[model samples]
Each structure stands twice: as C-alpha cells, then as structure tokens.
Target: MTRHPEVLWAQRSHKIYLTIALPDAKDVVIKCDPEGVFSFSATRADGESFKFDLELYGGILLEGSKINTGLRNIICSIKKENKVWWKRLLKSEGKPAPYIKVDWNKWCDESESDTHDSDDDYIRGNSEDNDSSEDDGLLYLPDLEKARRN
Candidate 1:
C-alpha cells in the first residue's frame, strides 16, 4: 500500500516552498509541469512507498522550478508564472488533504512581505540599536520585582 507523506507549504508572491517530510527517502522522483501539476514519489529504506500529486493553485515556470533532497525532507522551490500571491496551494480546494499543512515558519503575510523580506529581516530590524549587550534580537522583559522596586 502507498502512503502519503506530510507536505508543508509556504509562499511568497513569486515562489512557493513545498516540503515533503520523509526521512531517509530513496529513489525519489519529482515532476512539476507548467500546467500546475506537481507529483512526487519515493521509497523508504524499509521498502515502504510514498507518493502524492498536487494540482497547484496557479501555473508554474517549469524552467525555474528546483528540487533538493535531504536526509529529512525534500524541498521544492517552484517559481510562479504570474508572480502573484495564491489564495491557497491546491487548485480544487474545499479543504486540503490531511497530510498537507501550512508552513508557518516560512509563511509571510502579504501585508508584511513588503516591509520584511524574511523572518531574519524582522529580527534584525528589531535588534538594531538594541541596548542589551547580547546581539540576539529577542526582547528581554524586566523582572516584575525589579520594575516594582523602581
């Protein structure tokens, strides 16, 4: 029996990031067509087969799409033909499959996309001229007792 791997997706206006979570996958095959069809298949070391097909929300630039296989996941960077934000990942969506999910870590809101190129940029912007000795962008809250004393 074939299994569907968990897929996480995030998008920028011009590109989509698709991540297939399958550790130690072997004999992987991925295909993306200009008509917005994305297909993937792979086998695990134990001989279990995994596969899925996604009809993407919009047409893609086939020549610009890329795939990278890693020990933990396969990442596909798909360039959009129209260079606009998609309403959702799948074309025929009522609700997406259970295995598919939004990649919150990589997701940037359309409103914020212009202000920050990425999460790192937002962090860096917050940290600029930070009074703390540590250069980490995280804000440290003052202790309640210390604030009360002051």
Candidate 2:
C-alpha cells in the first residue's frame, strides 16, 4: 500500500524543483505542509501503489508550490518564501530524502500560472495523461485543491 518512488529535486537561485518518477500511476495524490513537508501517493492499473514523505529544505510559499504531471513523472516547482537556497534539499536534522537525477529541460519558467493553492492542510491531484502538455513530452500543470481542513 505504501512505496517510495524515485525522487529528484534541485534548486535554482529562487526556486526548488522536485520530481518523482512513477510510471502507470493513476489517481495520483500530493500534499504539502506549510512548514515544508511533501507527500504523495499513486496506484497503478494493477493495484500497485506508491507513497513517500519528505521535508523540504525550507518553508515555501504555499501559493507558489505547484505540481506538473507527465506521462511518466510528476514535478513540483516550489518557491522559497525566504528566497534562499537550503544547504540541502530537506530539513537539517535527518538523512535527506532519496534523490535522483533530473534532466535540465525539466526546469520550468516563471510565466506559467501557479496551479497549487492550499485552502486547507492537504491538496490532491491525479496522474492522467490526456493533457496537451503531456503530448509535448513535458509536464502538465495539475490544479490542486486542499484535501483537508485542520
């Protein structure tokens, strides 16, 4: 029921970019805590499932963190509220979240609209591929709604 997919993340001067490699995941779900915790889960057609939780390097602008889904991956573009890069990709206390390598083209631009907004404590999205952005072999921004209210 719970598994950790391959995750890749990087930081530019102003943003933290993260991607999870998961093929055949339907009904993908993602969540973020205002304090920088990130989590997600997905199921395959055959019922295989995956989920992972990682503490981001620092706090993020919940209004600016976003999810982009592709045919085989999911990417989150997060903005640092403090506008500074962390010494590492996650919290300073523990072992960092597992990391993977990402291609340079995965870096996105600022002009794209933000698709994530946490009206509550959690948010949700899917891994569908009918989107035009997926057709471009790039990721499609997924609109997210808060998944919880406490």
> What shift in Å separates residue 22 of candidate 2 from its native position after superposition?
0.4
Per-residue lDDT tens digits for candidate 2, residues 1-150, read 566888876565456767788877789999887788888889876888988787777887877566776667776777777865467776767675455454344433333213222211122333355332222122434345543432
lDDT of each: 0.77, 0.62
- Candidate 2, pairs of clashing residues: 122-147
Error of 1 at 140 (Å): 24
**Cα lDDT of model 1 by residue, 1-150, tens digit:** 999999988877877888889999999999888999999999999999999999999999987566667688887768889878899999996999999999876778887665543334322212344454321222133468988999
- Model 1 regions lying over 4 Å from their true place: 116-150
TM-scores, all models, native as reference: 0.77, 0.64
- TM for candidate 1 is 0.77
User: What C-alpha lDDT does candidate 2 achieve relative to the native structure?
Assistant: 0.62
Best by lDDT: 1
